[model samples]
Target: MFKAYFTDGGNPSDLVQLARIAESVGLDRQRAEAILASDEFTREVRQEEQLWLSRGVSSVPTVVFNGQYAVTGGQPVEAFVGAIRQIMSEAKGGTVS
Candidate 1:
């Protein structure tokens, strides 16, 4: 799917191409095609996309930690480490400060 999207410029709306791309990733091509043809994961993906859009997400590579905090764009390694530490600390009832 990533290759199809980035390399081939394939639209996510194209189910056949999506399944073929999934197969290229070593997934079960037949099952993948069926799943894409059906309304199973498609609805879930749309819902998640909508959820992110509602949260003012207007770009790709948006990373949401535990669905509470989010970091958008291609951040540096330190930024990712900081975000992880912050999320882990919050999960353990600690604050970033």
Candidate 2:
């Protein structure tokens, strides 16, 4: 869905079309539409926003490790692997340089 939205210029903000897409992906169309139309979606968004804020996240595309290390914004795959390796190393009482 995100791929289609970003690459194919699909409008994800269109709740009706998003619901249809959800149905195509094996979700119940009526249920998807109901959730999208209800205030529950807004509430969920707010809840997620609060959680992110509590985590000190203020941007999209954030990757965090052990709630201590993070790679915010765009990064290469090597950067992600490096973060994971560093976390694992630290977990093993080893130092990462």
Whose lDDT is greatest here?
Answer: 2
User: Per-residue lDDT for 1-97 in model 2, tens only?
Assistant: 8775888788988998899889989999999999988887787799878987887898778987886788888999999988888898889899766
Off by over 4 Å in 2: 66-69, 95-97
lDDT of 1 by residue, 1-97 (tens): 6767789788989888877778878999999978866787877899988988898888878888887688899999899899999888878898765
Model 2: how far is 4 from its true place, Å? 2.4
- lDDT score, candidate 2, position 1: 85
Query: What lDDT would candidate 2 get against the real structure?
Result: 0.86
lDDT of 1: 0.84
Residue 26 C-alpha lDDT in model 2: 99
lDDT of each: 0.84, 0.86
Worst 10 residues of 1 by lDDT: 1-10
TM-score of 2: 0.80
In the predicted model 1, the residue pairs found to clash are none
- Candidate 2 to native Cα RMSD, angstroms: 2.3
The reply for model 1, stretches above 4 Å from the true place, is: 7-14, 35-42, 95-97
